[model samples]
Target: MNDNFLNSANAPYVAELFYKYSQEPNSVDSSWRNFFNSLNEDDLSVLGDFGGPEWKKRPSNIIDEISFDKTIRPAPHINIESFKSSTLDSIRALRLIRAYRVNGHLIANLDPLNISKKDYHLELDYKSYGLNDNDLNKEIFIDGSLGLEKAPLKEIIKILKETYSSSIGVEFLHIQSPEQKQWVQERIEEVRNKTIFTPEGKKAIYHRLVESELFEQYLDKKFLGTKRYGIEGGESMIPGIEQIVKQACIAGVENIFIGTAHRGRLTLLSTVLGMPYKSILSKFQGYLNDPNEVLGSGDVKYHLGVSSDREFEGKKIHISLVPNPSHLEAVDPVVMGKVRAKQTQL
Candidate 1:
């Protein structure tokens, strides 16, 4: 109820009982479950004296106030101080895990140029949760978090860094839907946000990269003074787009509508959208005329639109790249309208 009733002597036991109740409410007595359910976060602070020396010295005092199951009682051989320390460590570790899910993106290695400054968040540090180098090797009960029941603090930190603070950072805790948030968390944490490609897959990606880079090089040479936006530094996007298309088709997506500005548009068209290089080159050589013109006027090659069908693993998908004016993102509404119309037709 209060500090007077739940002091250092019984705090560890109560905390352990509360953790058990949290994991499985039916495991504890109905009375204890009801009492724990009634307690708010502020009220649970009475269990904060978990690792105090006095509590370790007076383990017998825990049994005086409440009758716990024999399974909840510490064995005679088990050290009370160690048990108390582990309980406190588990609580702190949970807070550290939560901090990663919420703010780890602030410290992620996302800047490819390495020019941007990243602030160090104290919340993501073990010291902020009352842990130090000495505690790193200590095992704590995480209750199946990150797919582990218990793990050393060092291993837990390593997993968290790989999952949340690596080059691919995530900030999904802000999602309003619990199911969606949980699904994302599970999916990311399951693979630690890293995708492993087979040898063949790696080769495919390499070939795509080569195609993108060579295409950019050819354009730069052929059109010396032309303002044809290129994808030189970011050629990896070609393979990335291919992966998106493959995954979408695998997921039963039948259509994809893309709208974009001039940057990398030609590269996407030639590489990802299956547009022939000869066709694109004809536009570059001024052999093609704008479809909208009655007098056969020329249009910028980048502003041309195309629709193509691609098949991946026996699944066929239609991809439509909407034409845009010089204004950025101008084709977004047109793409949306086309999508709505297609849905109505379906």
Candidate 2:
């Protein structure tokens, strides 16, 4: 190759050729070997003109500088403190919002003996994460009416606690869509701020609570050791479901389908869905009124579902409790399919 090509755009290729020739000169073309030998002699003369020992070190130093410039030296500077603060903020937000998902399982081993309250500090620890009260003063964004603008971090944390740490803790932050997250945030915040329950509403809640307690007491006395799978611990489900049904009716939903396992089904059927007390009691007495109407013997009364068209807030809404087998979560797909069919019909 011509020496001029070494100084042209093909310097890298010539350098590679020289490297190969240095490794095995006999393997290279005779002309190329002669050219390389001439270049090597000229290089030795130049090195001799400059002091040989110092110039010998210069090649290694130049290679080091070239490697540094080409590969290692020009990294963009990052602010370590700012990066740390941002990471802490993300972790804190997850703790405040997403921790409820794991801690708030409906049938968790929270109070196995039903004695003491369960502790849930896995993600709620601030000191463990090197955060203090001073960190709360930093501004952060929440999905609220404020949009992209930030509020004090302390205020956001307070709102999260109030929104999430109630008797019924929620875990909606795992939802992916921004609009859905914002909707949940807005609704939670609304419920938090609108804390006033009307006198009639309070009375209704009390009535449901009393009725639930009385029903459990009656069944305990009448049945005596028979496994009703009673809603003794979860009496609040009665009033809670009433609120849901009321909300659904208010939202102009014409149909509501519920699918749950045996837990709390009897009380829900009788009290909320308006199944007759006599009918439920008749089933408990081992009598099947319409055995031949349905297929394959029958499920237990608790596993059976009831339907009703009820008037809520002066709106007629049809509600169906989809029957579930002894197996948990089996009715979920059945309920969903029914809901999809109803929606398609609508």
Candidate 3:
């Protein structure tokens, strides 16, 4: 595989295929039919498979090899490196490599998701640009508190930036909303701990910029903690989930069958199901304080099933959040089955 050939793109070929096939949602869009039919025999041959898949091997004659991939030329297996025996033969091989360079290029470009980007955000961070223990106050950690919250902004920034420098998005949010809250919105926006971590800073990785010191500066800052799966920061999504969860609770059904992946589990847990933060916190701290508390077998922080009773309209509804497997659509079928089973009982 000549690197040059790999540089060529397969987009044009793929676009052609898509354009020809897209019309098939109805019958076949007959527009391109006659246009492709007008090709000469040799040109038409290019549309067919070159012959077999084995010909991509570097060939002594470059022309023959690429021709083989494109089905343009018949393949004969001779040592490609051996073809370098003569200068003229080597040049011929180079030509073949160049000819179908676009073929390899096109195949790589076939990925619609990463069509334009080179290398695709490759994690080239060979330098583990982070802080070392000696750089921090180890004594501060002895009080049973993770000093990470108090670490200087520079240090914090270096650690997290290097850690997630190339990460497409923030991955986690350990949230525990309080029970009584009129300003749920305001409370969710409250930074439990806030600091900006940037690699290019004073003293490299040595500083503390606490949220208390810097929070009020941004009165209008929006999307403070917005994430794909978070309840707040991305917090505006709580009310809707609370409605569904509340409905389930009042139904008084012995079992509540929930069937969501990880959209907004926290709000549901806190506001709807009334799951205690202590229970969620206990799991994270490696200790379930309640010995008999039966935690659902491994579900995500958001996917934990909850059981509770609430008053819906005039009736009592028992809400049971079901334990979810990692599989989303996977759990969908199971929910369907559960629903059917319930229907049968009725």
Candidate 4:
């Protein structure tokens, strides 16, 4: 047979048909004979029973011939080297995109300090993935539920960059469970199309920042050099904690416990938990000291915990701060134990 058209991809099936024909041509299936006849007519002219001398000269073990072709025949149209290169390129492209999704956070602008940026080789650019400008114009299919039926690669990259490089950084790829990883990805990706916050919401966030800033500045002026453990840089924590408490209340969570070291505890207490500003000021002035009450050396005013009963979305939430030692994260176990005990009581 002329391998110009008939190659190893079809060779095994052809060999099987030839063996059947050699046994009984008339009994052979019509499809098999028709398939053989479809090959170059001129080549079939000189060939005898099995269609070609090349096939007839092979061993009687037709299975062995098919096996040999499967093992040894170089497929005519397929460029093996090119196929391997293409496969490797595809693998690298997949890995490149995955790396961007996983480690883009390493280079993200999450720090409020606006610290010096570090380059993480997320390999976001198309050329890094062996793709070019032309490839960005080509449409590619994504998950159907994503609503974006099909999008250009460039659009996908833009969405990824916008999603990862923002103030929020996603770190879900390290999640072991496939379902959990997918769930996180879906939620994070939803940010791409998430409706913009209303004007009122923006105004509220702005007000919170201003409140945080002014409170810190006031303390700085009133009590100079006195470490009130300010929330100066982490002003966003005000709105963030507010949002969390609001959501927890809406979700019907009865209690919300926050634990933090000296960094911003006082500001959070005064602002979010609604601790009395005069009382906090009195503590700073050493006028709020409990002279009668004693239990060894007491913690700093900022290290003291406070609880408040706040109503949100028509739900009552008991928000409490677990007093933390100067050692960072020391309150975590204490908070956890208290939470479990509370849950037991409930």
lDDT by candidate, in order shown: 0.75, 0.60, 0.37, 0.63
- Report the Cα lDDT for residue 230, model 1: 87
Candidate 2 to truth, TM: 0.56
- Cα TM-score of candidate 1: 0.78
Q: How far is 101's C-alpha from truth in model 1 (Å)? A: 1.1
Task: Give each model a TM-score.
Answer: 0.78, 0.56, 0.30, 0.67
Query: Model 2 clash pairs?
Result: none
What are the per-model C-alpha RMSD values against the true structure? 8.9, 19.8, 23.3, 14.6
Q: Candidate 4 at 155: error in angstroms?
A: 1.8
TM-score ranking, best first: 1, 4, 2, 3
lDDT (Cα) of model 2: 0.60
Model 2 ranges with Cα > 4 A deviation: 1-160, 164-170, 190-195, 288-298
Candidate 3: what lDDT?
0.37
- The sequence of per-residue lDDT tens digits that candidate 2 reaches over residues 22-87 is 667765556545655754343333212221122122122322233221112211343333432442
**Number of the top-ranking candidate, with TM-score as the measure:** 1
